[model samples]
Target: MNKTVNQKAWFLVLPVLILVGFSAVIPLMTVVNYSVQDTFGNNVFFWAGLDWFRDMLESERMWNALGRQLVFSGIILAIEVPLGIFVALNMPKKGFWASFCLVLMSLPLLIPWNVVGTIWQIFGRVDIGLLGYVLAKLGVNYNYTQNVIDAWATVIVMDVWHWTSLVALLAYAGLQSIPDAYYQAAKIDQASRWKVFRFIELPKMAGVLMIAILLRFMDSFMIYTEPFVVTGGGPGNATTFLSIDLVKMALGQFDLGPAAAFSLMYFLVILLISWVFYTVMTNLDKRDGV
Candidate 1:
């Protein structure tokens, strides 16, 4: 006899589907509409074909912003992935100190992005800020509002401080899932620390690390609020990533048509890159049997 399937449960999922349609699908449709058309005040819109897309494709400003975004994401991944793995390796596996350390590591991830920006903004001040004052006392010429390099450094350091904890936590969880039997076997074989880590732990942690990397890449690429509040995309647009540039176009300049087009392209880039990351990681997992 065949078992009965519950069709009524479908009704329960309908509310969530409706909510998503309103929240995401509807807004996406509006953006698509705006992207391919021109609008003036008084609710007037004219079909512009692909004019906005062509303009955005030719815009040097968009290209520069894309380069900066790529660089920023690259730097963050370079710093955070290795740093997180190292931190995870050293982190206590048990006891009160381990718990305390984990809690401390989590604090940064808990803070709001705007608040993180504000904290770093004040923290880097030349007068009242401890970091700025110390740097100034040491004769380091540091001014985020005036120097492009300093502004970039400030934003990079702030991001590192804020988000590295997330990588660490994910790595720690991956590390924890490795059974003690692996360590015992390694010890029985007289394996070196590096050998054990390379041959055993790293392979085990590969899946989670890929997930962490993908998440970090997406977040870093689309970062806006914190860097916006920190640098305001200034010191001559040194820290203006794509999202910041998109906002400047969409809201600051009120260039809706081009901004909408840019948004659509940006969404596609993120989606494409994330898809590549997932594919590569999945293949690696299959290869490593992890």
Candidate 2:
């Protein structure tokens, strides 16, 4: 006789399914509908077919935004990943300091994205902000609003301050999973600090590092609120990544059809990159017998 399964579990999952349907599926459907059609005032719509998609594809603005986005994400990842790993490697393994450091690291992650933007906005202000004031006192010219390079630097530094903690925390967790015995073994082999890290710690942390990379990449690629709040994609659109461009097209310029198409393509690019990361990570895990 076959054993009975917990078919009743479906009842518990039903609410979550409904919530997802409302939150994700419905909005997604709405976006799809808008992407394929054009609309005017009074809720009137006209069939546009693939016209929007074609236009977004051929648009130089979209390409420029996408290029800027890729560059920003690349810069963020390049700086953050290595810095996070280095910080993690130096954190206390056990004791009060460990707990203290962990809590400190998590504080940045706990702050709201908008709040992070606001905090940094004030932080880099040329008037009363500590950073700006200090830099100016030192005879340094620093103005995010006026200079594109300053705006980009401020955004990247803000991101590093806000989210590098996440990577460090992940790497720290990966470090924790390594048994003390491994360190003892490395010591027995008379391994240098770099040797221990390169041979033992790095291998173990690879999984979490991949996760950190994926998270950082996705977050940086789609980043909007912070930069928007700080720069408003100003200084001649120097920091106008794809999301800002999408907002500009949809709301600023009030071009719905092209905006929707641009958004869909943007979503696909993110999805595709995320898939590649997931595939590489899973394969690495398999190879390492993780």
Which one is best on lDDT? 1
Q: Estimate each model's TM-score.
A: 0.95, 0.94
Q: In candidate 1, what are the lDDT values of residues 1-290, reduced to their tens digit?
A: 99999999899999999999999999989999999999886889999999999999999999999999999999989999999999999999999989999999999999999999999999999998899889999999999889998998999999999999988999999999999999999999999999999999898788789989999999999999998998899978888999999999999999899999999999999999999889987886688665
Global local distance difference test of model 2 = 0.92
Poorly placed runs, candidate 1 (over 4 Å): 1-12
Worst 10 residues of 1 by lDDT: 281-290
lDDT of 2 by residue, 5-42 (tens): 99897899999999999999998888888889998867
Clashes of 1: 0
Provide the overall lDDT of each model, using Cα atoms, as 2-decimal numbers. Answer: 0.93, 0.92
Candidate 2: TM-score?
A: 0.94
Over 4 Å off, model 2: 1-13, 288-290
In candidate 1, the residue pairs with backbone N, CA or C atoms under 3 Å apart (3 or more residues apart, or in different chains) clash, namely none
